[model samples]
Target: MHLERLVFILEVVGQKGRATVADICAQSDLPKPTAYRLVQDLVSSGLLESPARGSFAIGKRLRRITLSDYSDPALLEVIAPVLANAASAYGAAFFLSRLRGHWVEILHVATPETGVSYLHPGIGKRPLHACSCAKAIAAVSPELLSRDELKGQLRQYTEHTITNREDLAAELEAIRAKGYAECVEELERGISSVATTLTKTGAGSTVSIGATASVRVFTPATRNKIGKALSEMSQELSCALGWNDADAERICA
Candidate 1:
């Protein structure tokens, strides 16, 4: 009975976007006190967000749960061909990633036959400010990083890394205007990358795709090519994910 009531409360909140104690009680047909207690339990456990004194919505823990499940085989099966094509066209490694909490989580990587000369960050969480995929995800959603958050995490991994919060802001603006982000040996010496946000999940989280190679391989012309490729790939992926074609074009444009 307790589990059923809890699930009923979560369902009501999820369907309504947000709910107050009265809203949950009315929707779930529970007594006001019981509804309030269940909602408070969810908020305390991090499964729901208390946005105000009484209002609640889905929380980061639930978002994290959805993101972690992005490794579902069907989604990967659909994305594999696209990554292969992008990797082949640009002669660089391609990857898919998402912004989760304060870190960028690497979801997938598709490398060229020759492999990349630069060291990969591997498949795991990476610092948001230091990688092109993260920057691209951030470019589309700047509110994810408060000024204080940026300042606190501006650890320099290489001489080219953006250590200044102001400079990073300017760079992100440029990336937004141009539809892609770049990391020039920022995370590792001799490595550079171009990236674009691929799509937003149904839960409203940003996911990105990118290509990277050694600085030597990513020449001025190569960067431009990769930038365009990343943008096009983002659009295609967004469409496959059921994003409106016109909206996707405007975002990637």
Candidate 2:
């Protein structure tokens, strides 16, 4: 029964590309307790990973076994040099993020070998309304925000965080026009970050990359500089992943 349940759950995830425990329970007619326990065990064993609450994506073990085309595993490794270079050049920290199914989350971070650092946006989910990485990706792909409760329920991480849905929409429009997003004391009082979404989309997900540093160091002039740099990096990273400007343009169009 355990093996059968495991295989059935894997099949459901494979078919949906990603699936929630509820999805499994509904499809397989499995009891809630049975489905939840199996999914939890799979996630713990690296056979699955929960990218969002109640959402499961293939884990590293499965990716390796299937040689999946998704770049989640290799993304950070392939771009390590890029992130390190940018971080070193700016004397700050950099990170990568992704939106799969319906949510966006930080995947990795790169920091300068030695620098006068002020704050670091630790890896994992940050408030969507206050995170540059999440906003950059969500601006281009609004559907990614579907899994998040936005409507009038934006979380205010700091006083500077935008709590109004309309204001968030306006901010996203600006990000779309500027080709990047910035956070100034929004997520944290003295931490700032700049990010841009990869114009290219793949494997049913959108990718974003960004850098973070102290608010004092990321001043107006430095903010613009870092924002532009991240935009260019987004393009380069997208192109490297077998996607070109034309591909993204067609999708956006």
Candidate 3:
């Protein structure tokens, strides 16, 4: 009975973006009485929206649930403190981003108390090649973009940004080998970042720590330290996402 109702609901929405009880009953192959009762129940439970008259569509509650589940809060909680600590220690801003469709969206950011930085990405989308967080993830996950697509158009966000496809490809290869990426005022002058990819059970994500500093700040020694911390935080996040230690190590390492 529940399965039948679920199928009918999906079918109703599939046929029409919104539906009335009578319309759903006819399209879903259910009796009018059953369709009406189920639709009322779904609407009451906040799964369906009834804005005017008898029209119904998927509701905001369901939409929020879908987004929240996909961008799991439990996983974010595990990494938040790590980012905060990194930001505090380095006196910089740290960000965690995830690839959302064709864009990278910043999910979290931590700003340092000491440094006065101008750029704040906030919760917004950034171009794949323009930000260190996006590039770090893309470097390890070339499957994220098609070869032809990547080669076709690479925008230069700044003079130092990698606009050439061939050069960017080579840089990505190095990032993959070394398990980290760095942007030395490449996206904007006076801003630098070091980033690493985060993966869980074969699912890939990225986190970057950025500061208002010169290229000199990203010395080999500093990068090594940051890389170690980033690797640890990635592992913790992967575990929160249901990845076993072996899987987490393989993905983050």
- Candidate that scores best on lDDT: 2
Q: Which sections of candidate 3 miss by over 4 Å?
A: 1-68, 113-121, 147-152, 206-216, 244-253
For model 2, name the residue pairs that clash: none
User: In terms of TM-score, which candidate is strongest?
Assistant: 2
lDDT of 3 by residue, 1-253 (tens): 6766865574454224566887666544578888888888877888778878788876777767654333335445666777777677876667877654456667678777666543455676666776767777888677766645455457776788888766877888887777777777677776666777665224545433333334566666776677767766666666565544455765546
Candidate 3 global lDDT: 0.65
Candidate 1 yields a Cα-based lDDT of 0.73
In terms of TM-score, how similar is model 3 to the real structure? 0.63
Per-residue CA lDDT of model 2 for 8-104, tens digit only, reads 7876676456788887776656899989999999999998998888899888898899775544556665677898888777888899877533345
**TM-score list, all predictions:** 0.67, 0.70, 0.63
Cα lDDT for residue 180, candidate 3: 73
Consecutive 10-residue window with the lowest summed lDDT within model 1 = 66-75
- Report, for every candidate in turn, its global Cα lDDT versus the true structure: 0.73, 0.75, 0.65
Error of 2 at 130 (Å): 1.2
RMSD of each: 10.6, 7.5, 10.1
